[model samples]
Target: MMTVVRLMALALLLACGLAQPASAQVQAQAPAQAQLRNPATLAVEGPVLPGETVEVAIAFAPREGWHGYWFNPGDAGKGMELRWDLPPGWRAGEPRYPVPETLFAFGFMNHVYKSPYAVLVPLTVPADAAEGPTLIGVRAEYLACSDSLCVRETAELIGNVVVGADGRRDPRFARWEAKIPPRIDATARVEREGETLRIAIPLPQTQALGRPHVFIAEDGLVQYGEQQAFYRGEDRLVAVLAAKGDANPSSLSGVLRFGNSGRGIAFTAERGPVGLGSTTPLEASNAPSIGWLFLAAFVGGIVLNILPCVFPILSLKALHLARAGESESAARRDALAYTGGVMIAVLGLGVLLLALRAGGEQVGWAFQLQQPGIVLALLVLVTAITANLAGVFELPTLAGRRQASGSFATGLLAAFIATPCTGPFMAAALGAALILPTQYALGLFAALGLGFALPFLLLGFVPALRSRLPRPGGWMAHFRRWMALPMGVTALAVLWLAVRIGGWPFAAIGLAIALVVIAMLMGAGRRQRGGRPVGGGMIAGGLAVVLALAVVAPRWIDEVEADAGVLDPADFSEATLAQAKATGRPVFLWFTADWCLTCKVNEKVAIEREATRDAFADAGVIAIRGDWTRSNPAITRYLESKGVAGIPLYVWIDRDGEEQVLPQVLGPDSLIDLAGASPKTPARGTPQ
Candidate 1:
């Protein structure tokens, strides 16, 4: 909510416009007795020449725990006002303020200078003015505020400047000028869309940015307290800001604060198209190189083989590995074929992801699982695999060539299912892929595929490892049948995911389609056993499945309620996050999806437990749950902001706004320990 003070300030600006000087506004609210809590003094820097401009500095030294405002006081507070009294034909320019720190108090944002600071105003002398000492003075009025209190202060400051005398320049003027932000050489462009303002500023790609912030000088142009999102392209920086009310202006002027370094660049933006360019986050300048990202992706892929989501697919691969022990050449061939399959699948998905994002889609890793159609397809495929494992059907083996094809198909399935479960190093690699260049990003994806296939590839090439495997025997059949159990479980999980993403009706139709496909497969198996042709049944079954999907696609709608757990967390949103942090309570924010097995595992082990719940209750923790079961732009943006591509992301923001990102794998005591940690005193305007 916009505060009344800010609203009134904006209304006054709209009514009076820029033509009405700040001094008049100050005089309207001036107190009879001046408050000098934050004392001000005036100084002239120079031996001013007749027609030249010399800077006049209004220096302020605020008392402890008190601060003065900038030219634009942000959401609330009064900007300093100056009523200049100079000789005829003399002129004064607008006051130039140094970059100010942000203060967040009671849901309002204030731009203030806490320590000693100066505002430089250029005073231009007339060409006809006498070359002699002249008196210059200003009645400065401003607001001084501590954390809980504010006072309107006024001061009458005077300075003398000798026009013709050779007076030495004040050394202090150099320091004051350094504090002021210099104007950028390139022009910036801004565009307004509804309540959002997007500004594109040209900057070198090599420029290092740390938590960049934009301070718009135009009153009512933007909601000062709203979170600003920054992104970087090849040679441009884009800033997204929320506009305040219905205010629309032809041009905008502001200062771009480069993190907390007290350095900024002043920019004026005119109405124009602002291209978002790449989805790269501004922090990517500090990100690791492509080689490191590739290595991380590879390692992450190896770890995925151990997660529960890949177990169903790994079962088939295990059998393939055992068969590889037969002959070295055969084993190598199978390995290469399987590796090719995995690479093709992983890279294909990566290409699709990149293309969709380029086409302006808000999506992330495991994005296919969000679609009901894709989920249904997966369910049907897993069901067929389960039936084959259970001996209800058998896929005909075509000697060496068939073996290779089977390995390749298995690789494709493994990569598709395994990608959803981000393990260890995979998150960072995948997150960087979203912002990296096309060629480099594709390399990372290829690295992930190669890594995933490395273990199997090794088995095919290394005879020593192959010899260690148990010899193919009569027990192999029994093992395959037992493997059906996990595959069956995988099918059930996919069905559940379908229900979670779509409604019960959609899930029911999908289940019927899967059953129809399974029945057709079983019929074909029976025919094969009876030594008859079975191709017609499979073709008919495929047609039936396609027809059913076509009929139900349009009617699909998401109606499933969010999963309930012991924690009883609130649904996450940007507004909710802000409100939670504003309360000065510890926040436990976790992102999950029905399709993510790791997310569920963490919930069962660490989150949805009586101990964790009690700890949170005792600590007064605010739990926020972000469900990514469907395509949510907000959740996607939040994940990108945290430098991750997918979730099972657990972020703990303490009362003081310090954030600690918990690991993907959570222990039973992880949340318990977090809740028990000592609280720190909340700091004003701390970044969350």
Candidate 2:
């Protein structure tokens, strides 16, 4: 027992004190030898003959769980770079990289070599080179990364080659040479649209291609992260790639690979049309049926009534409905005229939009609002309405004696106001309509007009609804005065839009014109109240002058604003979105326009709030906003891709690349909750 106790005490002493030196020796010995061995090996693949070319390779066999990069590293990483030290009259060409496999890391896709790969470099031996052995040296720089960590590596390489000898090529080098892409004589055409480049390569019609991918050779010309879409044509293969960095390139050279075949053809691009005209060639199988499109258009028009832009006009019309106590036949006649007005306005605008699109102009819903003149015209019209509603002047009654003409004009105004506020259901139908056959497209627009007129049409035919309305009385006068408030607000909103579209000079001039028109309206109202005969003619002349001035003022102000050359901060684009996405974090996208009331309201109440900003910061969310105040093809194409008809588009892309689309009308809490940092209770941004 005493002997065992003495042994235990000796073991404890060794464990506590004497083990430190032994452990240190083991760790020190193990690290020195491992660190000295390089992970890569450099070799000369062929004997360097006098005045002959030879090949050299820098081969890497990575450690377990680590990998190196290809020529175009993709997303994030550094490709191998070599600085060659050659003798006099010796030259080194660009390195030839083997085809790399796709590896994903940290929410990014990387082109990497996971196991073993070799990069070959060509050397030119001068005619005057000596016959003895020559020393070739290189310094290589590269990056290696595992799933969790990344490390940069630098290697110094040296190799000896016998000059003036019969060169024997390495069989291993032959294997890598076979993997190099062969240059093809195929015709390549490239078309540029916004930041996207579309390349069309003429492939033999008889050949069948399965899942082809294009690997671009030039750096800073294409975004490596966005998916490249390939479309097979009868005799051509087309690829759509996102462009980055430089806009102008002499040629785009890339390798086109078929799935897993280790075979590809490389070609340089030339600028020309691919015979596609203006329409994008999408797969026909994914298109919705015509019936579904019509239904979507109808439903979208119905939803428009609830939009902020249209709802206020509806409120104004509701007050007018209370005074409809005329004979049933007369009331029905006025309703039909109003319905005709709304239908004509919608159909006419649709025709104009289609005409412009057919003429190769890129336009979409509420495209007229992009015109400063049209905005200013609408402002004048709305201002006149506000004055009339405020009892500045009584509009002359139509031949029917109940302002049937006024009802028709109101319908026209309502249709105009409703154009800017596109809802969810409208997006798909309208997007398809823009690209569908002409007759079918027109039919969709007509259906939308019918839907817009539905509510008023029902009131016209249904006598019961009219009977239920309150009788006209002294209360209407008070209501008309109150109604002017919203109308006045609408006028101010238009003036604000003018400022946004043009500048402060435009707004100041517009406000001055509005005040002048108001004075004329009051004068006419006084003259009519005094029983004067010529008051109506003066008011008519004044309205005409107001319209003329509003149209002409924009040209003058545009020159000045153009000279000032101010930049708007909110015009986020696809390139900006791409940059934000490259961060491997969440992104919040918002599309808005100067004329969209709901967009403005959402911007103020939800997007621009301090809480929302804080939530976004906490969640590492990047906020990007797109401005659609003008005709922007890039923005239009982006909207089409997402099936959005107009502004107030909210898109949330998470870290894992899943997308969530938020509602057009949003509250601060909706975005705040969505931007929360909890992964377990991740906020869903999809529209309800």
Winning model by TM-score: 1
**How would you encode candidate 1's per-residue C-alpha lDDT over 1-688 as one tens digit per residue?**
3357787644544464522345643653443333466888888998888999999999989988988998888887888878989999999998898888999876778899998999999999999889879998889878777665565677888889889768898877766765676564345789987789988876544333456899998887888889998888754678999987776667989988766656566778888887675647665643355666788999988888887667657567766766776678888888998899999999999999987765446678879888877887788888888888888777843111237887888888889988876888888888777766678779989999998999999998988998898876677778778778887888887887778888787888778877877787788779888998878757686767767675775497567779667888888887778777777878899999888888888999999999999998788788899999988877876675555678778888788655667889999999999899846444333223
Q: Model 2, 437: alpha-carbon shift in Å?
A: 1.6
lDDT of 1: 0.78
Per-candidate TM-score against the hidden true structure: 0.60, 0.56
Residue 468, candidate 2: how far off, in angstroms?
Answer: 3.4
Maximum-lDDT candidate: 1
Model 1 regions lying over 4 Å from their true place = 1-287, 397-402, 535-538, 680-688
Q: State how far residue 59 of model 2 sits from its true place (Å).
A: 49
Each prediction's number of clashing residue pairs: 0, 0
Instruction: Report every candidate's CA lDDT.
Output: 0.78, 0.68
